[model samples]
Target: MFRVLVLILAFVANPSRAAAAPPDVDLELVLAVDTSGSIDIGEARVQRLGYLETLRHPDFINAVKSGYLGRIAIGYFEWGGKVNESSVVAWQVIEDAKDAEAFAAKLEARPIATRHGTSISSAIRFGTRLIETNAYFGARRILDLSGDGFNNTGLPIAVARNDALARGIVINGLVILIRPTVSTVPLERYYAECVIGGPGSFMIPVRNVEDFASAVRQKLLLEVGGLTPSLTAQPAAMHAPVDCRVGEKYPSFVEPAFRN
Candidate 1:
């Protein structure tokens, strides 16, 4: 069944999976982490190591294999003032267990070496270019931007979102909410409304950096398998009400197998 789906998706994608551009990279997903001034070195390590740990877990491997095609392209970058931001991993195509292991190992070995302004736009643009420059076009292309602030530099988010969407890029977000008195609800909404683009885009907010693991898992599941992204971590109070308004926004990608 998975093979058939891969063939179909690959077939619809022009001559061959390798032939397509832009939305290239079978199951491409970018990890856009925050290294802005707000994040101290300890917090940055937590964020970086958190994802490296998640990728090393067996569950992430299973998630990578969840797609009919086991191939996935990934790129990592730090977002901040355009000057402070740069790519951690250029463009990596993980096609199997060894590839995933190597990529995870590399990430684990990489040190936290960025501290600058938090510009979500720079990260988004970097991810978009990574996808556009790749030879592998996956069934899914996602720019997973995790940050604690809204856009403050470079291009405005709306224009960047349009550019990404025009190229069939899905900009899912991982918004880290830490302030007790300050709710990150507005930030998450900003992501959902302005930051992310494409048919099936969503955002998840992590109230605390400690919960980053679970949030990373949830985001990974949704990104690779096309699961419905919702705030399952209910606060004593709900910020975005989960109502019967199902499939109201992201109605494009959803399936039974994807829920895995």
Candidate 2:
């Protein structure tokens, strides 16, 4: 009994484990993709392919190399409910074509899975935590959110968005206007006013299926280079007034998988 107690005490006293120091990079980006039930399998496939192509695209690689450090850390995650944030790919350093190809290959190996609800706020919070714990120190940390619907579960998005902004983390959006006709409030407006924040934060709405690849490439360029795309030439409605709480009007039927 004394020997067992001594062993327990030793274990408690020396509980520390060595951890690698975080490396420095130009940017740390979390690609938070939506996998809510609203997005069908076909749509999900398109999104996956779009990201894979963007990762391997020459334009994106050039943008990455344009940075002073010529490298960036990136991670891919699928978000839906408060607890349904799944990591599709871990953080990877992209310094050249070979590194980018390896990252794309990892993404392609993951099985596409969908969750039950749309929790944009949860995604933001999850992404912020990821940035905090990653093995890289980025000059600019960014959360690139891509989603079709609005927040229907988890904490309020405004709170999460504000928290992230307060930490100097930029949150951008890729508003996939998959069902513009069905939604009363234009999603682009919702994303502009409520979703995105921090310096150089902006969103590009993809209205047509064919434009996904081009828009993604452009978005990646902006993100990697820390450049804000000019929105002055866009339609007035794209910057129109919005009700951030519009999504709250819907009944909450989905329970979070993380919270029992």
Candidate 3:
């Protein structure tokens, strides 16, 4: 009777300590997409549709099931100069096809809007915060960032990238090159040198709009399965290292209103 009273007292003193902890997930993935002025509505739509389809793909579903926990938590958000609350899709756990479809539907329903500036650093910082504060504990945390341009605003890309790496968060890149940018450095090289870091980190460049869907699906597969691509499939190494600050040197590229 005395031990029981002591236990009850402890529970009353620390209710949270007696409560169940957050669920464990195989991976915590934050999908940080660029909605800078450079991406027109059509291009944005393509990105949105590509992700929606990829989530429902059989290969991606299989990858999720192959995880040790058979589940992963994902959060989606669009970032430009800064992250807006309206652009964020709260974290969702995906363990099966139904969950994937529901999360994709939530993303598809959100209205797309492009904002000024290209701030990859802002996106990275925001993603890190989301991971740090999320309710699930994951075996691996990844920030999958997609962008058409470089980091022209906010903190330095290396700073944010390194900070995330220090927190054991892997950063991957999707370099969308369907449209041209003013920067002389190849976008892929820039991403390799500055934006992506941590173990198994890589960047995939989409040179054609037609390849966007496949590239996204392939990236999701590799990340979900925790596998790295072969050396031949990796981004080609450049003769000289890229200037990480090159984006800050050039003006932000804005798509013309008439262009699709």
Candidate 4:
């Protein structure tokens, strides 16, 4: 019995018996898609299809292949007022076309849903937690947040964004402009000033329905390659600064009549 106890103690103290280190990857990306009430079933379908196609595209595949580690870890989740476990797709490592296909298939199989509220802050917080807790160490951590409207619930946007940024997570935006909102502030301008940050951060505005897929594909390629678009291709500089707190200050702005 003494010998057995000694053996057990030795095993417990052994470094090798400790939890294994997470794998290293070129990037750890969380695709926080918006499924807020403003996004109708058709729009939700389009968003999902856009991501599915982008994941399988040659350009995105090539970008992943060219990474320093020749691999990336990606996760997908839908967000609105808040997040739930059911809406999150697990992380997957992509090193080749087959891996990418499998990841896309997982997202495709999940049912598209739209929850109430436009809580961009909550999405950012959730994305940060996912990256922090995932089983991979990435050279770069990014949260690619796509949304049609401003944040109307949860913590302040800047607070959540700053927290993520402090932890070295880059936030990029896919600003959907197809829906008209009560705010006169251009969604692109709002995202640029208040949403996106960190190295090589940028936002692409989808002004028309036809541009949705291409915008998503382009953003993914840039993110996978860790490259920022040229100055001319980025959103134009705003002559007037936008009030980042506009959404929170006017909760009524998220009402059905004002939503996209």
Candidate 5:
């Protein structure tokens, strides 16, 4: 009787520990989309559509079911500036076309929120928090951050990247380079050096808006299957190494104009 009472008291003291374990999936993916001031309305819409179509793609559904567990968990969020991260969709499992279609519908129905400034660092931290709180456990944790501009606010991105990597999160990036006129260094290079980290982390750059869909499809496959795309398949612009400090240097040229 005393042992039963002690066990009951222990369960009561730590209810979370006694709670049912989260469902296990092959991958826990957080799609952290950028809605910073630089993104603008048309570009933002393109990004949203890119994601929607990718989610609804037959190949993506196949990739989800190819795993041992035959399922993956996903969440969506938008981020910009400090304190502007918003979860667009809660964690959900994807095992078949129906689940993927439902997730796509949610994306289609979401209203976009406009925010100012770019804070990739904050987005990374937000992804980390989502991974920590999600009700599904995945063999792999991946944060897919899509952005067009450098990190201009919040903590340094390298710090956040290192922290997330330390916690076993793989950070990948979809570098939106449609506005090359606004960038001093290649956006893909920025993502490769300062943003993405962890085993098999990679960045896919899309120069033309039309390529967004295919790039996302391929990126999703690579992530879900834990397969690396051939280096030869990478865009020609990424062949040369780039300076990692380019993101840090961007504000020195752009911030003064914003202040004025």
Candidate 6:
């Protein structure tokens, strides 16, 4: 199995020995970030800061703590293509404020260059593999997808999305409309209509790059715990998780789970 170890505060708090496993969080969140060539270095910086700022935000911290077990597992990765990509942060379980900040600090310290392609399918595939490896499938599995554009390479989004849903995985979208000459609601429509899926899945578009922080805050609030969408803020219904083992898309995207 592909594995890399890092000191995680949650692991310390709930140590799992060789013969035993720790109690899992009620949710496993996979944050898939876009590092495609389309996103310039400056914009990537803005997107990167959005995550750091969210982790720094007290509201996000509270949201993490608000889970049924007062904790949630999270992993962050950057995907733009099948190769020449890297990990932003590994699978993490934030059981407390300290753990959350540790993740933020790690991201802040990493320096990134722009050379990845827009491969949303591969990103989703990576996310599913990550969650399965965490052994937190029984927990609520969420693949948090953030990107500025549509899927161009690898598998078709609907195919991957439908497969993810069939595996009881919820995929939420954070669609960023960079320097949109017109309005961003249209871009978000693409998300709601195409990219976003799974139970309670919804997309939050950052119309203005300046609004990135706010969008992240709102999305995190809803994504972590089951929070209702705000009608005042482009309200949309959330998608329900699906498992099509015996239905359409059966055995789709479920191979990674088994392989893991």
Q: What is the TM-score of each candidate against the true structure?
A: 0.77, 0.82, 0.84, 0.84, 0.80, 0.76
Where does model 1 exceed 4 Å of error?
1-25, 83-87, 180-185, 230-260
Q: Write the per-residue lDDT of candidate 6 for residues 59-81, one digit (tens) a residue.
A: 88788777656778788878775
Better of 1 and 3 by lDDT: 3
| Global lDDT of each candidate | 0.67, 0.78, 0.82, 0.82, 0.77, 0.68
lDDT per residue, candidate 5, 1-260, as tens digits?
Answer: 64344334323422443355433677889999888887788878888888888888888888888876789999998987853534468788999999998988888888876688888888888888888677776667899998888887766677677778777678999988887636666676678788998878888888887898888888889999878777766455535566554455233332211110
On residues 1-260, what C-alpha lDDT tens digit does candidate 1 reach at each position? Answer: 76556556544433344354333344878787877777777778888777877777777777777666566788777766652333477567765667777887877766676555655666777777777676666776678888777666655555566777766677888887775224334666666666766656788878887988888877887787767565466558545642212212322433221010
RMSD of each: 9.1, 10.7, 9.8, 10.3, 9.2, 8.8
Candidate 6: Cα lDDT at 157: 64
Candidate 2's residue-wise lDDT over 151-195, tens digit each? Answer: 867777777888787666789999988666366876777888889
Q: What is the lDDT of residue 23 in candidate 2?
A: 31
Give a tens-digit lDDT track for model 3, residues 57-140: 999999999976699999999988878669899999999999999999999899999999998988998898898788876667
Position 189, candidate 3: lDDT: 73
Model 2 TM-score (2 dp) = 0.82
Model 1 residue 138 CA deviation in Å: 1.1
